[model samples]
Target: MTTTPFSVGTFADGDAPPFPGIVVDGRVHDTRAVLPAAASTAALLTDWDAALTALQSFADAPAGAGIPVGDVRVLAPVQPPGQLFAAGANYREHVIQITVAHRIGAAGASEAELRQQAERELDERAAHGEPFVWTGVSTSISGPYDDVILPDVGEDFDWELELGVVIGKVTRNVSAEEALDSVAGYTICNDISTRSLIGRPDVPMMGADWLRAKNQPTFFPTGPYLVPARFVPDPLNLDITLRLNGETMQKGSTGDMIFTPAALISYLSCHVILHPGDMIITGSPAGNGSHYGRFLQPGDVMDCEITGLGTQRNHCRTTEH
Candidate 1:
């Protein structure tokens, strides 16, 4: 793909319902109108290289082809990827934060000692550990600007803004040396969490309960754009910023990822085949709501951004029981 702004979305004109659109600047160019074959974002992903070529041609066409991105509702970038792969504790600082909490209950570990152990573990994991990959249901996805319906009980709802990687090709056991070739692009993903519900108390030894805590409706607010790989010169260097109610809550960078995008792809592919449109959202950085005890509440707004990919603003609401 060239340096063309390649963002695919679903938008409707005057309540006519939504259609796949290629977002260029502030305007939305219809993908179905321009190229019938590449009608939906999923369809476009099936052959990303060709779809990108078609998009490039349309982008260079005469100015009268698209309409302004007015008040049309912007749906999730596409249907949820065929598989959603999320990395856990992939950032060095994130490990530190998680470690501090986990070891806080340890009998004799000092705070400094806990932090040191966490840092050391990060280095060892990056050098020899396989990436920890988890699966998420696609139903959790909502529009980029959609309202997040918080559960009525879990009071520790938090925000974790991370970069989402969109796979473009069929890849199996691909080497890290050539993993970038399989990536289609990147997007912004907020892995909203009900922190208190992560563990299963009844099944004392089963470990994390990802499905219950992370798969609630509107739990994952994804994408205002799908920035093609070519546009993001270095995925590891982008800045990630997220604010709650206009107050900066999470501020970090992809550079801190203990498992880089390539590493995660290579390690993950060694086990399962990655299909086109599969997403691997690299883990969130430190400074989550847990850090400051500033968990999300109804009426609070979250503004998340990942460099050139774009920003997403979501409001929090709780439906009456």
Candidate 2:
């Protein structure tokens, strides 16, 4: 059993401004309204267990005592995190799919033999290679239900639904066993991408430019809820699903990730000190838009959800010229 229940965002109605909220038995308890001390979700995340303990009174209240769930406009549970890290190519299946898509031959002369050889190399890489992680600017983040404006210059607008790990404490050089202890909660993050912009022809020597390829405004739509880590026992087993206009586009599981959240955290902590409210999004599962030849366009709606984390629905709108 967990101390803190699922957390939600605040807003009396869809049109209202967002506030901090905690969901208890279908009711929304404003964290600020219930306990004057919790000013923001980010503040509570600094010491989530203690915050929950302090607000135990509200958690114990009757079902209907707080605001109705439907009445609240659920925003991103936390403010823009202090640091944002996005793991790249951390899913084994996703990496294999990319290799197959590009038709890069492997260790043999024949196609069938080449595939077998490729699989072996992939297995070896998974066993020994380190996770590829990238940094993302916080300004790219937007509310869960906000409109995602499609950049006019880029045609292939894609989505990568991932499990976002929220850091609860300052951690550095932690072991994999201790890494999970620092997690405050889990949230759904859509790591939106512009496929065409990934290539930098002139700066090929500089390698991939993630900044221009990924840092567009509203590129990351995160959180309808932040399911406290205590409530979610296994972050790696969650089923990740994303729907586009009622059709399922991406469906996979966190179990497929090559690098576990704990390993990623431990590796990241070795390089940089992770602080409370820092967000590290585990790599997306195999079914991104690039795989299906389906990309976002005006009027497209993306409804994405993980096993326990709440869902997010964002409408795609064309950028104003």
Candidate 3:
């Protein structure tokens, strides 16, 4: 395994077709000559072991001219993953945030009391509860710097910045201890949701409507690059932060996660088969728009970043279509 620190991403030069490139020292080197199978970043991930070896060799000594990262448009590292799984209520504080937003507590209880109650619930969950994983449409994936068009269907457009784990191989029924072995790398993703559309009161038996509430196009802002898992050191200890319009909004650490990536993946593998290039986004931290009661507005800019996994700046615009 190569220990050299490097990342992979998709980039294009001014209307030119996008190509996968090896990113090191702030420059992007085309992988076309280095790894013939790398038609896309997702393809490279299918055979991540061999691809990582070739990429490390190329990074050590680039074969050709490299382009300055700023000269080209950086796209989502994995345009459309094979499968996208999202974990909900995976952060202690985030669970409390959601519960408080929905008033899922004793009627007339104070916020402090509700918060404490949520904390107790979380402690119980950590001891006994299984992770709650859900499927998300892959088409919702968008480039890191892409504009988030607030769909006219819902008013509460929100942001939930998260840590995304990319699968390296076909895996099924893996244990938590071995789940990390299947992880190729990590990236950043903002799971944008429409708060107003989350509920299915008309058909209350169905619970939350994650599909319509979360799968809007350009909603899942992901990736500037995918940093190899070897460079991450400890996935659970990374810092997660999001600033809205230059003001700090969400600030927390991955350590606050109620379910670790491995635990979540292990739980998921019991039913769903994870394939190369599949993704599982661990839940967001506490400070989502719901916690602040301030949702995304037209022209709002959100700066999201995770330790090592590059940053994403997405501007929100109102879109009728």
Candidate 4:
């Protein structure tokens, strides 16, 4: 009695508008055919519990025979989430690499000294530090297969592949122990950034200008689909990998994260009411272009994947003037 594994996403055929679809065995079945509440992926998420039940039922006895996946255009699982929260510097190794490269906080220190200092700081932060979370405009989202149009203003566009968590129920001040219960599903996201625009020379004390550096259109390439939380056994143990033009650029395990997804969600919920369809992207692993002294160029391609969520392949092109 083996059950077919399934995920959900938005898709379109020919010129038809996007609709929520259940994906199983490389086939797409219109979710509306079974669940009228699924007018859109966002709408379906509003009642995620009921939606999950109906989706599971549909998976048990699917109708319409599901269309071949290749025939439809896959869109981002949730386009322009109601709210998008991103955690930065959550991975200890990534922080150590960045700290050593930039000489952060310990300027003029030797590389070995910087590495030792960064490790000690990470240990302290992991024991008592809150995640560095921030708001991101949802319009930056693009489909998994869409072209990432490098903005004209920035010279160093880089990739930061991350795990995206989708909120299911209304979540406020949830405890870390119970945070997983609030998750609807998980997806893959590439948090693209403009390295040159991250700092503000005009206001050095103000810290990194995340909005300017990261919120450009098509900067966030998310989802081939969203796998329900039930399908993922352990969010913190998945492997995250990314390749640029067929060369592996980033590869690390979620185990390296200083603040786990549940912790980040719990921390975020303390401040804001997380509604269904809101997204939280956990920070990326080490190996951003900045670390390697490489940056996106026209015609570059990025291939990214997490263990079970899915894969995303995006082409990079300069925006037309």
Candidate 5:
């Protein structure tokens, strides 16, 4: 079957063009054209056959059915996900860069110290390197075009652009080959974070959860649209890039991931029941703000793009106290 282009947007009146956008099952609709609408796309995801049929019809319909992308504001595709899973150190270079950065600059430790630290950390991780890590509540999710607010409570704010997968079917103990069949679609996610919060030296126990650091309001700017899984011939072969303002910050490919999506799904399935509308954010590549000697500030615009998934532009703004 052919792939469908899934979009969510507000429809403009007869004369104006329709706003093209995408939405996950249940999310807050931001388009002024559309009244306050909160709905979940989960029902549409339970059956791949029905979901694909609906998406195909939607995509075939002309630019207006009261679903114009131009009129409606595009929010993160998924809403109230059952699980927001993430991969830590999924990219080898990122792991190296993060470790090196923490050791030399913030951690104030020598190479040997860093190596020892990383080894000890890895040893602990190795013991528990199961599937994926489940994050906190949905309060941490945000739209792709939304402004990333820097928390006044923290100093080290960082950005991580990752390719997010939206699950379609429920399956447990699925094999790597079977994993791909569960994917509903793909979208872009910027895992905005507060390094200081997760990397505090005083909280030796907390260490860096990466999950908490990455989940903040307006932190996961996703969407533009959800490209049906069939469209992605090879999920691992896509090119992923991140730009600050107009300057390129990260240029890499999904091929660099330490664990493929299939592997991740297989591993994750072993631990928890995978269900529809669950999200898995493949780890970000190198050139993240933390590793590149930069941190987001008020007014900075971040553009995150993945090949085939489209681009999501996010502006950095501080919330008024």
Candidate 6:
């Protein structure tokens, strides 16, 4: 499938600019000051096939007549999604850390014991290596360069960088082989979380419920731009990295995933219906806060990047109640 090539830009320090050759009347104005309204909007708005088609026509216009690619302010490819789905423990190393952290107390178990227990658990889980999925509401979505608000209710904010997939069409019960067909593109996402909410003891599930921690508003920072699936022939072989205030924090690759994107889509379709504009965060690699004793603090900055997809930079701030 061929996708129209589009450029992404962000405001240097404020609201999106409205330069005539940049973005005018809410649509991108190419170099000739010709407004391809639909294309500009379609890139950000999904489930609007007509708009996307219009965008293609606009992009095809003579080079000079097209919007000046460098003029417009580019924000995250998709501002909000219809549904945001996330997978947990999708990597062997991550799962091991989660299991040990949850089962053993805050004191943390010995490395030898942790490894032994993880090995045993893996032996059992390998037979049913399925993705553990959860949903994040639309309110939690933030732009790649937007600020990530740390809730004042807790001080255990953390970060998990993962590859996020954007659904292009409505789909249900799709096979693993057909999964890529339904994907429109990919982006980088930082699953900012609060450990206090995730580790709550009063919850009926005995802290088994991590949604509260993971689903805080503006917690999921995604995109600089969505690289059309065609640009990335293999989503499972990219490098991923996370940094805190210019300091390297975590580094790994999609190759470490216990469940691939195809398998994850297949597993999710068995229970829920996915549609255009939906998002699926494929899970992170090792070195998350829960495992390394590192947690996010206010005023901290996080920069995450995926090989094919672009970078996402967000500053930590206190969330007002």
Best by lDDT: 4
Question: 184-240, model 6: which lDDT tens digit per residue?
Answer: 778888988887776556656664556777778778887766666766888989999
> What ranking emerges by lDDT with the best candidate at the front?
4, 3, 1, 2, 6, 5
- Tens-digit per-residue lDDT, 1-321, candidate 3: 545678998999988899998887888888877888679888898899999889988888777678899888998898556699999989988888888777889999988889899999999999999998888999999999999998879778889999999999999999999999999999999999999999988999989999999999999998999898988999999999999999999999999999899999899999988998888999988888877889999989999999989899999987753
Clashes of each: 0, 0, 0, 0, 18, 11
Q: What does candidate 4's lDDT look like per residue over 1-321, in tens digits?
A: 656679999998998888899998788999998887568999889899999988888887887678988889999998546699999999999999999988886667899999999999999999988899989999999899999999879679999999999999899998999999999999999999998998999999999999999999989999999899989989988999999999999999998989999999999999999999999999999999999999999999999999998889999988782
Where in model 5 is the C-alpha error above 4 Å? Answer: 1-39, 57-68, 102-134, 200-203, 209-212
Q: Which prediction has the highest TM-score against the true structure?
A: 4
Candidate closer to the true structure by TM-score (higher is better), 2 or 5? 2
Model 2, residue pairs in steric clash: none
Q: What is the C-alpha lDDT of each candidate?
A: 0.85, 0.82, 0.90, 0.91, 0.69, 0.70
What would the per-residue lDDT of candidate 2 be over residues 44-90, giving only the tens digit for each residue?
77776788676665675533477777776666667645689999997
Task: Sort by TM-score, best first.
Answer: 4, 3, 1, 2, 6, 5
**TM-score of every model?**
0.94, 0.92, 0.96, 0.97, 0.79, 0.80
User: Candidate 1 overall Cα lDDT vs. reference?
Assistant: 0.85
Model 5, position 216, has a per-residue lDDT of 63
Which regions of candidate 4 are displaced past 4 Å?
105-108
Candidate 5, lDDT over the whole model: 0.69
Candidate 3 segments whose C-alpha is farther than 4 A from its true place? none
Q: Least accurate stretch of 10 residues (summed lDDT) in model 1?
A: 1-10
